[model samples]
Every structure is written in structure tokens, then in C-alpha cells.
Target: MWRSGSDAGAIAIGVVVEVPTPGTAVKHPEALGADLWRTDEPDLDEPRTGIRLQEIRLTSQEGFLPRVVVKADLALSSASIITMPNGTVFPLDATQANAMERLWGLTTSQSLPALPGASEGQRKLMSHYRRERSNTLRLKKLAEVRARHGKCVCALCGIDDSSKYPRQLSERIFEVHHLLPLATAATPVRTTLDDLVVLCASCHRAVHATSAVEDNYAVLAGHLRGES
Candidate 1:
């Protein structure tokens, strides 16, 4: 996809897997709104259920965009990575290596007829991937905090996991809460350390119990301290 065009400002890359046909025992859930292709197309070497990788690129004439919205879901096929222009690599999952190898052989030689933009189905799938990507990014930023501060602690209640539970149990109970949800953002926004807070499951649920909570950790903290 990198060699597609010089003006490529943004790109979405994902591996595709076949959905089970009707009356077949289900394995993977149907890739809801996958970019399906025709088996009878001249591009196929033989007639079979075909799965083509989906790619969406933004070839903006307005020049370089500092940030572009790209979405992905590793759960569909756990063999993918997103490498940025800066050389930073995000390794998603290594479990599906064999499946990816087979998919590569099937799709590498097939050429697709060029279309103007993303199809409606592709756009719908992109929306799903975007939400997943947003959550994953938030978790990554939260992991960084755990690495630096050394343990998970509720930012509002000041209850450190290490203080309340055994090591293994404590790790499982903590959750990362985003101060501002990605759905509310007007544009592509990068997550930062200051934007996430560690909260125990109970606190996390309480924070989101009402619409007025507003994803504001500070407000939740104030209420907990009887100051709100």
C-alpha cells in the first residue's frame, strides 16, 4: 500500500479472513461489513471464497497532514502491525503468523480494479476499527503510566492496587480510564500520559454511572473527597 501513491496522507491496512458460510459450524464471527470480493472475477486463479485485504488511503491535495485517522482491529486476524513514517512500530499480535502467511499467498498476486473511494461497507468496518483503535491507544498510554509509577492506583480514590490485593489479583482488578472519550473528539487526537487515570473496576463503573460524570477524573476525585 505504501507504493500506491506519493500523495498518500493516511492509510488503513488490515488482513482479511473468510467468514463461515451458512450451515457451517461458526469459527470466527462474521467480519461484519468486510470488503468482500467476487470469486468469479478474472483476478482469481480459481473459484473459491475470497478474502481481500482492505486498504483506505487519503491522497489529500492539501499537503501533508500532521495526523490522519487510521483504524484497525487485530482481533479479526492477530497478525498485523502498524508502522508509522517516523519508523516507530506498533506490534499488535504475533499469534496469527501462519494464517497471515496463507492469506499473503492468496492475495499477493490478485490485482484489484481501481475505485474512486472507500465503499459503504468498507466505511462501516472502518468505523468499527476506529473505535477499537481508540481503546487500544488509550490502554497503551495507560501501560506507560504503570511502567513509570510501578503499579496501578485509583487516581480519584488514591487506593493503590498493591496495597489492597495480592500482586496477581491486584493487576487484574485495575482498569485504565480515559479522561476524554475518543467518540467526543472532533479530530484525530494523540493520547498522552496526562489524559489517562488508573481506577479500580468499582471506581471505573461509578465514574461512568451518570451522564454528568463527563469522563473527568478530577470531578470524580472531588466527589469522592466530599468536595464536589
Candidate 2:
């Protein structure tokens, strides 16, 4: 039997596992997988299934034959689980879901003919990877900038939207710009704060107006300053 509980914005799922016969080899529930777990209940609420899980915590009961407690960032549904070759069902990890999404894109692109220079599959994969990587880095950059400077300001235009608009609105206007294009790296490269610059919406758009603009930050700043 499984029971669901919620406390302070976290949902916890209590799983009860039957003890196997004596001398039978069994894996500890917590040892199954770091990101995914199997659940027997399937007839959970059908409407709210497939919610993305951000983090999960597994705790063991302090008794003989301990039960496992799963606390997740969001509610989980059986629909998010995958059936293995042995017929056991396991919940899908967030990382695995992302990988599956990319695989699906590649699989669908197989039906379409390749483009002349870059194939549709390649474009989709690169775009997806860059978007995900940039988003993660952008959030980190924003937090770091805010912590160190108390506010985010555009490096090029020298505009501090926080002074003109509400904090939430001003934050939306600022973006983290990458000094080097993510696609240019031949292999995965470690990104540092030095590789990022804060820019407001307008200046960011201008910087991305052309491929050349990315490499000419000085020129863009000069034009913004009305300098010849």
C-alpha cells in the first residue's frame, strides 16, 4: 500500500514493500536508482499525471524492515513511470525525461530529408542543448550578480531597470549574455562567471542583431553611446 502526504510545499510518498522469502537476494529500495523508483500503485489521479519532479528525498523508517519515504518537489503519477523489459515499472527521472525528449526529436526528424548544410536533427539537438544549458547558466549568473552588486545592470547600455520598474519586472528585462557561443565549443567546456555579461533586453537584442555583433562588444557600445 502507498500513502501520500504533503507538508510545507513538499509531497511525500510512503512505499511499503513486502519482504521476500528468506535467502532470496533483494536490493534495498533506496539502492534501486538514485533518480527513479518503482511504485505499485497505478490508479492514481489520472488528470494530474506527468508533473516534472525537480528533486526527491528518500528516507528509511527507523525500525526493522524499514519502509521507504519519498519526498518530491512535486506530486508524482504512475503515468510517469516506465515499464522495464522484466515488466517492472519505474518512475522516469527528470534527466531521463529530457534525454527521451531529445531522442523523440531525432526520431521524428528521421522522416524528413536532411538540409544542405545542417540537418534538421542536428539543428534541433543543438538548439535544445544550448537552450537548456543557457537557461541554467542564466539563473546562476543572475543570482551571483544580484548577490554581489545588489542589482543587475546592463554592462553595455548602463541601464538599471530596477530603478525604473518593479523588481520582478526589472529582472525580466535583464538577460545573461554569453561571451562565447555555446555551439563553438568542440567539447563540453566549463562555464565561468567571466564568460557571462548582464545586458538589458534592448542591448541584448542589439548585441545579437548579427553574428558579427557578438564579437564586437566595443563597437556595439560605441554605437549605443552615439560615438563615431
> What TM-score does prediction 1 earn?
0.39
Candidate 2: which stretches are off by over 4 Å?
A: 1-136
lDDT of 1: 0.50
Q: lDDT value for candidate 2? A: 0.51
lDDT of model 2, residue 111: 47
Best-matching candidate per lDDT: 2
Question: Please, what are the lDDT tens digits per residue for candidate 2 over residues 1-228?
Answer: 111332111122222343432222333222222222245533222221222222222232211111121222122322233222223344557655444344323234444565577543242322212222435567878888888878887888888866788866887899988788666766445677789988988888888887775666778888878995
TM-score of each: 0.39, 0.44
Steric clash pairs (candidate 2): none
Model 1 stretches with alpha carbons more than 4 Å out: 1-130, 134-143, 186-188, 215-218
Error of 2 at 105 (Å): 10
| lDDT score, candidate 2, position 50 | 23
